[model samples]
Target: TPTAVASTIKAKNYIKTITYDNSQEDFVEKWLDQVFSEALQIRSDNKFTDEVPQRYEVPIIGFDCLKSATTLIFMNLKSNKYEIIDRPGPRSCPIHIIVKSTENSIHLKFIDAKNYVSADMELDDFLRDIGKVEPCESLIKESWLLLSAIDNRIKDYTDYHIDLLQNASLAKLSCLKKYAYCYKNFNISSCYNPEDKANPFDLSMRYWKSKVNSYNEQDKRKKRRIDHNITYDDYQHFHDVFLTQRCHMCQARFTYNNKPTLDRIVNEKSHTKINVLPCCPYCNNLPMTISNQEVYDSLRNDMRNIKISDCAIRKPYLRIASQLNQKRRDVNAQHHYKWLTLQQIIQNMDYIHVTDDDTDSLCLAIAH
Candidate 1:
């Protein structure tokens, strides 16, 4: 035989399991290579000696590794069993790796054997400790994004509720879904319900009202002085002329001491005679007026000049004016006959000629 070449392959006694604490990187690699080479040598006697077949293209399981860690796991590719290589690392090591196996899968976990302190734990560290498992990072990031969106949506709904409460408008309650969808990812089970007795938004609204009432009370307290010199005659006259009377301009009755200011009085230019009509606050502020005769003359002239095309515009005006005239006639009849109802005097007679637009403008004036 030729000079015998000592094979890089080691003998059967070559250590199948190696453990090292505080081992240099090169030494660890060399040790692993030798173990693998020895394993290969042991199987060489079989017919498959020319081909070293791998059971899996990649390691079936992979996780973090630290020097001096004990308990390595080796897979017997052919047997589909894990060999728990105990006494795997040197003594006085900070970390250990443990391997446990169920029927079909190998589980690896890192154990911190020593009580040595490390840097503050980070997300990455936690991830590494758990091993590079699939889909974990992506799942965490998606969850966080959803949480942030929900938080912002809740804040928006809260602000919207406050605005609606302040304005005393219930119209937007119909759009609860539009507002709620902002928190769609959070699975919030309910939307804002102002009528719900236990709702925090409703409770907060009540609290706000109470605070406002307190502030109003304080303001009243600060302005408590009365002007005693103001004469009853003047007060009574003003009350009669403005407060107790109906606004001649828009025909709204006022019961409060504060009547609509002259600036807000609409249709004030429609009054005429100084003596024929009382100089109510509204009439006194008129820009122009038609005397009784002038009104009759105007009505008669307009009727005479009416054209077919003008009928469209004139018809509405005439209809409303006729209703107003009828109301006036009825009032005069009641006053003349001394048969006016107390209710009519107190609530003011219903004047159906008043258009909705006129009614709204009159209400605003009365509110002042």
Candidate 2:
């Protein structure tokens, strides 16, 4: 270890860097080869370099090492551990972090062997300049999910270690739960880290997101399919029919993003003036075969009874709901038969016989 530390000085490293997270391993894995390429003779090696750059001629101050390197990595690195050499600090620091404190002075210690290399400062000048680091756990979780889904370990400090260092408080490494995840791998006795476990949250937020996305897509598609007679002004007029956007069938007040939608009084009919109501998506989604008048009558009666029922709102509300349920079924039966009649007329439109006068009137209307 001492010889390794001494070798860095022999290597003629120029600028040094100190980091607070696990970036050393990444630097060595990614950047080391590009710095010291082939044909460059290392100082420790006994063999002669074949293609030496023709700039310098000496062995220790030779063109071989000179061409290859101006800096070196002073890192003591191994599996899950990295330490900076000759730096005065605790070994446990992955990325060095020190919170600001009240006491005026700091014990300035940089080099262990040299006494004159360090000096104390009254202010934490470096921290004073660098502002607060932004924590982005959601972005981290997104990436982690992808890696976990593939059952892959994070390849570098940039992949996971930086996030861990930043979000030190909410570190839920190797999450066992579906809602949360984390990266910590050791001493995980009971909890399974969701970050480490890929398929735990169904391995597919995208699928569910797409499913939810279709709702909005369907609404847009519905608007496009509106009758040619129903212009933008007609839509504005329909919206003005309601004092507030409320569900016609269930009478649920439209709130949040539940969204106000248009419902046909009868599914067989188009969005004519008498055939549509402004309602909640919940009511529109329910394929009720009852007329809007029946729905309104049932809901209104239920509301009146609910308000004046002498009992507290909570206890007998279900009774009013129950009474309306029977009335709805009766109304639904009547509307269903009427809807079938309309369907038959629609189906027989091409086959139905017409008088010469009727045909002439239809042709003239089409021609005009």
Candidate 3:
């Protein structure tokens, strides 16, 4: 790895040197032309500074040119910097980096993570910061959870911190187990099995196609162009997310009640890789008229009443499901009250006339 990085740096330096040489020659020629035109003599100091700037050979670590497509962990020896790139999406590669400024301090800024944690902060402070970020707070959490799994001290902070730590750890354990293939020889085709009906990739493809057909039919009826331009590779990435077994929207484990549904994060967007995420059916069914921010805001509001738990359904998810259950109960209660009121009104009435046209509607109301 060092040799490869050295060769790469050497090639880059050589090209830079050639360009610098050409530019310097041009400048010297121009200077000489001016000097001769004015009859001037060149002068220079005999002494040259002996001090030489230190140079560090770049040491590329834990990075494979091909295998590191998903994640890249490497160090720049010259800058003494560490970087972690997570480009899990299919259509684009968003960069994530960790910069070290002092021996005891590091600054982390990750777009996918959506938050930064300073190494100098106390454990409590870090937890406090993590609590502020809602929904898919950290890709770095996977690494931190793995560390906590190995070393218990990292998670032995406080009750609240431990709850958050365990939530993330369990998410990592439940979701990341699917990535068992050898990265160096990983074949995307291996994820799919034509004969296996239970295969997630196949299931996702079927679901994606059904949705595409459904949407296209609706759009055609409305005289709008079919906008679902999602590719097979994009759907495959959605399946990879499904293999995580957690809802990307609410971080809930996939269960019978809460099956995985591939959905657009923003309803206005097409089913592209970056726009799509694996969420539960309930979240998938959220009103399309709502803006992405409004949808998340509603979920966040529902999440406020829930506390972090060790269950497969975490706080943010359970709250929404519970809210649905509560709404169903409320509807039932309202129907029962209306039915009783109708019965009382009928009992108080004298002979009433019933027409054939109103009979079916009346029976349906009575049944409810």
The candidate that achieves the highest TM-score relative to the unseen native structure: 3
Provide the TM-score for each candidate, comma-separated: 0.15, 0.19, 0.25
Task: For residues 300-361, write the lDDT of model 3, one tens digit per residue.
Answer: 33221233232311111211212133232333323522332332212111111111222222
TM-score order of candidates, top first: 3, 2, 1
For candidate 2, the TM-score is 0.19
Backbone clashes for every candidate come to: 1, 13, 0
lDDT of 2 by residue, 282-323 (tens): 334433433455533332332210122212211111101101
What Cα-based lDDT does every candidate model obtain? 0.29, 0.28, 0.33
- Write model 1 residue lDDT over 124-206, tens digit each, in one string: 54334322322243433423332233234335446433221111112333233233343234221222211212211111334
lDDT of 1: 0.29
Better of 1 and 2 by TM-score: 2
TM-score of 3: 0.25
Residue 59 lDDT in candidate 3: 19
Ranking by lDDT: 3, 1, 2
